[model samples]
Target: MTPPASLKLASHEGRAAEAAPGPEAALAIRGLTVSYGQTPAVFSADATFPARTMSAIVGPNGAGKSTLLKAALGVIPRVSGEVTAFGRPVAEARERIAYVPQRASVDWDFPATAGDVVLMGLYRRMGLLGRVTGAHRRTVRACLGRVGMADFEGRQIGELSGGQQQRVFLARALAQGADLYLLDEPFAGVDAATERAIIDVLKALRDEGRAVVAVHHDLSTVTRYFEHVLMLNVRPVAEGPVETAFTAEALDATYGGRLAATHMDSLILATA
Candidate 1:
């Protein structure tokens, strides 16, 4: 049988070479390999995320899901790989990209107010030595409003509850006005209402031609939200449209025998 369309996007071991992503892709990673000391994390991963779409990165625990985002951003070292944002190297395309790390990874008691946090997102656009103008404050307010956090702007970031905090972080990303967004578990620990709020903002971004790629854990919600799926198990298991690539077999390969609890078959229309 032929390999799945998502798996055909590229080769993890370099056996089936694929061409570089074209201009239409908002983010692309090829031959991405990451290692810590002698231990390897991600190996030869490849995938291209097109613009104006939402993509989900899913995998079992320790499957290198978070590694993909950090490695691509160069926050961690990469043994080898090529990462591009709108066809430009990540370092060269910082302004066009926004990253919202897992909320738990940050210390909420950092003393910054919510408004202050969002202002940081505008620094790149304002440039060095450029002051935050009245116009800049207006933009921050608008972004906060978009995330339903307008009333929380002046409050201490740490004082807010879990869902409110996530919205604040999203407001910061909006203030950046990025063309591509990489978010890690934005829904983790958030209430259903907050999750809906965040997903709505993400959908709005996609509608505006921006790419939203997120590391998600709710296997049941992948097809409900993402247009594309990238399944990882220390390497690429599958990658492509959710309709075809997010099959039970593909998920089985990615999660091994651990797939039973999710009842993922109910989420898909059929086996691949």
Candidate 2:
């Protein structure tokens, strides 16, 4: 069955924005909290994500890293405090932001080609009543080429390998053309080559004067992959450059217990 026309249109508009830059953020967040039913996932998280930098949200599992990103986008039901994009409230400025969810969260068997998925990013600009024109198609093709997936436009998403599928989603997010990108676990469960490719795309986005925030796992790659870091575990642990925030003390605070401390000690001594 064909997907709803509205979905396709919304997708296209999201992608169209990628062709140009968006306004910069002034004071992005003050006090943000996200809760799941009675339990709080992210608590009083505050940080300013400057324009034109690559930031990584790093922590152990259940650290509410993903919750923070979702809260910023208003995807989760319960959230408090302020989140602004380009100096405006997030709800009022949703068009300037884009999100790429974790690959494992999606249903690969969903009937959609790579191009169809990429076009979904353009939906915001095209509106529900809009049709996908030749320009949109060309934009989609160019986005695919940018990610080295131009030849896979017609392939079923389910048929692609894990790395290939991840790249497709990244391409879709690139197609969105937003200034602020919120990506969740984009590098999870992929090959080393795929990881490097994803990092390159993120750096390119940063070079274009856009902010890219990603919820990432690999502690080793955090320093190398991102220019800024938000380390979390149910609350704000640290926020700054990788050299400062990724320290032994901060990692212990975010991770808790002895395991993190032990690992951190070794990491510190080795670095010294």
Candidate 3:
């Protein structure tokens, strides 16, 4: 089958390949490989998420979806490969990127209010010994309000419901004033209302000329929520506009025959 026009297929030679990200690329990864004690998690991955677009990274369980994000962000070590944000090294462009980890990975038991957690996003501006001025508190309040958590600002994180907690974390990311947003399962375990709210915010960011990339699990919502897609297993299967790259052939390559025929048909029909 012919690949999508913009999709970047893994090199047949089993070597790391570069992406033709062009000039507008907001985040680019080439030949990224990661391992945990000799067990490979990701291999020769290549992807490019461009500015002003919203993209989704989709794959089956244990597909190293989250590992890819961590490696690109320099939060975890990669065995090989390079990652750049806005055509610069991730370290040099750190402030331009914001990452929201899987909600399940966070410690909700921490003794902090919803507002306090959001305030952490501004820590870079506040400095280690700096005191939070009234302006900072207002900024925090504004971020919470943007995610519909304004009324819950004083509530402890652990006391909130799953959806509320997710919204609070998103508000925290919003406070970062970032040009690129990386979210890991932002819609996982959330109510329908929360999912709608979150997607709206992400779309708004895209409209504002920022980039949003998420390690997403729900294939059913991928076409509705995103403009571009990166289908991945350990390596990239396809990467490009959703309408072109999100085909059954690409999905099969990424899943390695794990998806049942009936489920795949239904998903195609739903997205179509």
State the C-alpha lDDT per candidate: 0.86, 0.79, 0.86
Worst 10 residues of 3 by lDDT: 9-18
Query: Under the 3 Å rule for N, CA and C atoms, how many clashes does model 2 have?
Result: 22
TM-score preference between candidates 2 and 3, better one: 3
Please give the ranking of all candidate structures by TM-score, highest first, separated by commas.
Answer: 3, 1, 2
Candidate 1 lDDT over 5-96, as tens digits, reads 33543342243123432226678888899987787789888878777789999999888889999999988889998898876899999999
Give the alpha carbon lDDT tens digit for every residue of 72-114 in model 3: 9988999998888877899999899988988999889999999
Q: Runs in model 1 with CA error above 4 Å?
A: 1-23, 270-272
Q: Residue 86 in candidate 2 has what lDDT? A: 69
lDDT of 3 at 113: 99
Prediction 2 TM-score vs. true: 0.86
True-structure lDDT of candidate 3 = 0.86
Candidate number that wins on TM-score, 1 or 2: 1
| Model 3 deviation from native, Cα RMSD in Å | 5.1
Minimum summed lDDT over a 10-residue window in model 1 is located at 14-23
